[model samples]
Target chain A: MQDFLTIDALSKYYANGFEALKSINLRVKESEILALLGPNGAGKTTLISTICGISKFTSGKITLAGHDIIKNYRAARKMIGMVPQELSLESFETVMNTLRFSRGLFGKAPNDSYLEELLEQLSLLDKRNSQILELSGGMKRRLSIAKALSHEPQLLFLDEPTAGVDVELRKDMWLLVRHLRNEGVTVILTTHYIEEAEEIADRVGIIDKGQLLLVEEKESLMQRLGQKQLTIELQNRLEELPTKLSDYDIVLAADRQSLNYTYNMRSGRTGINQILSSLTQSGIIIKDLQTKQSSLEDIFMSLVNETAK
Target chain B: MNYYGIKAIYKFEIARFFRTLFQSFVSPVIATSLYFVVFGAAIGSRIQEVDGVSYGSFIVPGLIMLTVITQSISNGSFGIFFPKFIGTIYELLSAPVNFFEIVLGYVGAAATKSLFIGLVILGTSTLFVEFNVIYPGLMILFLILTCVSFALLGFILGIWAKNFEQLQLVPLLIVTPMVFLGGSFYSISMLSPFWQTVSLFNPVVYLISGFRWCFFGISDVSITTSLLAVFSFMTLCLAIIAWIFKSGWQLRT
Candidate 1:
């Protein structure tokens, strides 16, 4: 993948002396959907604001398509589009006027055809003539996205794009984002919904407490931190683990009906065969066996806790 | 600098103003008519004349300037302040439009509204009393300058204000006093000599004098001094706004 945007040594300090961002460095490649997952107060919004040139960085450099964000703000801003968390539009303005005005702000010639296409894509064509104040919350959110896309920016940043949305709407928005990616746009998403990221993100970056915990491919991250639980139901109840099978370090249920074995998937030697052979040699009959795999949420929580330390 | 960006924001702001035409246009007309009836007729009857001009005629320029000043400040401040207050400033800030372009679009629309209200008041004045326009060129210049200056003042106020109450402070506490003390209903010369001298410190006095000079060719302050004060205030306010836009002070974070 080719690097399309680069953020180096970024930091933000408010006038009130709050250090919201501490020296962040990240590289976003072209045509990749990168999800920035974080809990509250993790600097996700601050980082996006600084990169987009809306919030000034205390000290750092950001390059968008090789253009320095600070030195060449107009060019950098032109190449990037942002959908902020707030669904703020001129309440008195019609949907059509809002998009047209936003398009004109970029100095692009008025093209009704292009605007119509954008509105249609956003599912706002039906409400184009309606005032923003008349729209529902979901429609307003869609209008926000439409306005941002009017200029057709290459790098799109979505800050909690699906917050407070229902399951159906959320799924529709994810599909729309995926469509944008297919059209050769690079997307950077920030969300508190872990499942949203796990379902759609190609790469996941976890940030916590103003620091980047880790950035890795979603599959490899799971493989690296994932664990497994193997449960065996004995044919007969037992008072305790056999003295020989105690070496396996299995936990016997309080009722003595089952044994649970926890092991790291990354470890090559789980010794499952050894445990089975030993159990059989001791005449302990096994009735059923099952295994459970760790989910992405497990990895996310551990990563957050690991960074806290 | 980008043509499309300016057009986009300009068109949006203008559309918003017109969308609220009932309040934006109708209220100003009603307010201006009331001022004419009360201040121009009631007050003008007690005061016969000022600076060799009819009292009713003399207050016309002052009334128009007052309307323009208040509208300019209100439109400019509210246009930006409400978006910020409701968290919609984020949409504008994150858009491809630069800060300068955003200001131009918003303040430009405000200035246009102020000019429209000023002209409407001027037209309404003719219905009540006869006034002459001695210097059309100077009148246009002063009208344009007043709108721009107050619009910038509103921009600063919008950025500095955190709540609706703070937004009303400058218009209520600051602008009202300036307009009333600037000689809207009476000539500064009518006050004692000491008060007339003290009035020079109020910038609105110069604006009123300059605008009045356009209609009657008579002014309490020197023409050159009035022009100089206006240009200086415009420059200073523009500089502060430009700095705020560059720093993204309150608008961004």
Candidate 2:
């Protein structure tokens, strides 16, 4: 109950009998940033929407800062700030008024200084007087965050805050999320970008087909599911690995100019030296070589596949 | 009640209304004026009087009712519909505001726009033909109730409509024709007995007759019946809206 947010036995069944969420239970630690990663239509949005009270649940309860979402809906809602996945803004409204209006919607009194600081933090001070329609797409996304932060909710939900954003804006958003977490605001964001979760999430929750596959600390999830790969590019393309090189398990590049060897990092014998020596003995010329560490994407795929099986 | 939330939405709607002044205010006023020109002057010149009231003055209340009812619905429907259309309703729905406050913000702003446009049309009508309100208080009351009720209807239509064609279907083909046949241009008493009886069933008749009664002390239906009719219709609209919110019908998925 003392945790920032909690969902217990939550289920949502639409009128058409499509089950969007099934008996989901989870807890969000205070002042931490948790990212929910999933492919499209995997109930990521449904989960956030249900928790935010945008969509009603058929059964179960949600509590925000100990306020029951159903019985004390207003109080529960007041503790949450959500930036919806949709790029829906009042295009005619200026950035300043949009923040003011959003703050007012949350039943908060006017505080221009706090709003100005939020805008400054989001790098939107210059566009404060500009209508949202006049701003760039990236700027609009930033404004959405500024609007959500106006009421200073204890828990913030950024639903794909940088889904279509450019690299620069995404970096800027990552910094903002870190700053918010440092300020004691717990953030729960849903992202299709695995790299985003890896970049900012203290804890990552992978969901697929309306099921939460796993929730774990970022470092542990990566260590347990991660694999490393070694790639060698030959100076010349070959149809297949030569006979002497065949003993080393390898994957040929689609273009037939490269080979990749993958192995568990925790294993004592990687056998990489044997493979390299064998390639040299087989008279295959290696023009370049690179190694890649497994990212959250691999873990996510394996987790999704494991659950599907 | 979320007073500030209501004000936020209300102000936003008002700003949107003002932003598109030519479309929202001027166009309706011009259209109402054209109705005055065509029906009041052009046609009235041919027929001097209808039921002892000057022909030009007789159509005044009906024309206002016609515009007010349509304006309320259009403004109300579009006010909420555009958000749903553009997917902005998600943000509003996610806000801390309750369903009643959301409705109040949208429908209230819509009703205000209808009232504004209705008054503008009334002012425009004065330039064509002079008229009087025998019961000024009742005229305002009916005006408010009609605007609010029809606005609620439009909000429902906005929610239920899946496309633009469906949105205009009721107001254009159904409601507009009902208003014209409901005695906007001519008195129901001027019609034959069979046709007049059918006109009684058109709900707009009571609204127009009640509104017109306040103007010329003459009406097709009693003022009490007209008031009751509009009140009950408003109550029905409210009930439907309540049900929509409770069931999370189209709003939640």
Which digits, one per residue and each the tens of the lDDT, describe model 2 over residues A1-309?
157788888888877998888888899989999999888888998999988878888898888888998788888887888898888888887889888888888888889999999888888898889988999888888888888889999889999888888899899999999999999999999998767888999999888777788888988865665578999998998787777666666889999999999876766788788888888888889899999986655666778788679
List clash counts for every candidate, in order. 10, 0
* Local distance difference test values of all predictions, in order: 0.84, 0.87
CA shift of A108, model 1, Å:
2.5
Clashing pairs in 1: A101-B8, A104-B4, A104-B5, A104-B8, A105-B4, A105-B5, A105-B8, A106-B5, A107-B4, A107-B5
TM-score of chain A of each: 0.80, 0.80
- Evaluate fnat for each of the predicted models and list the values in order: 0.74, 0.62
**TM-score (0 to 1) of chain B, per candidate?**
0.96, 0.97
Residues B82-126, candidate 1, lDDT per residue (tens digit)? 878877676677566665777788889899888988898899889
User: Candidate 2 regions off by >4 Å?
Assistant: A15-17, A229-309
lDDT of 1: 0.84
What would the TM-scores of all predictions be? 0.89, 0.88
Cα lDDT tens digits, model 1, A5-99, are 99888888878988888888888899899999888778898889888867877898899889998788778888787888877677877888877
Can you write out model 2's per-residue Cα lDDT over B1-253, one digit (the tens) per residue? Answer: 6788889889888988988988988888888888788878887878868767898999999989998999999998998889888887876777778778988999999999999888878788889998777899889999999999999999999998888888999999899999999999888988999999999999999999999999999999999999999999999998899898878788877
Q: Please report the candidate that would top DockQ against the real structure.
A: 1
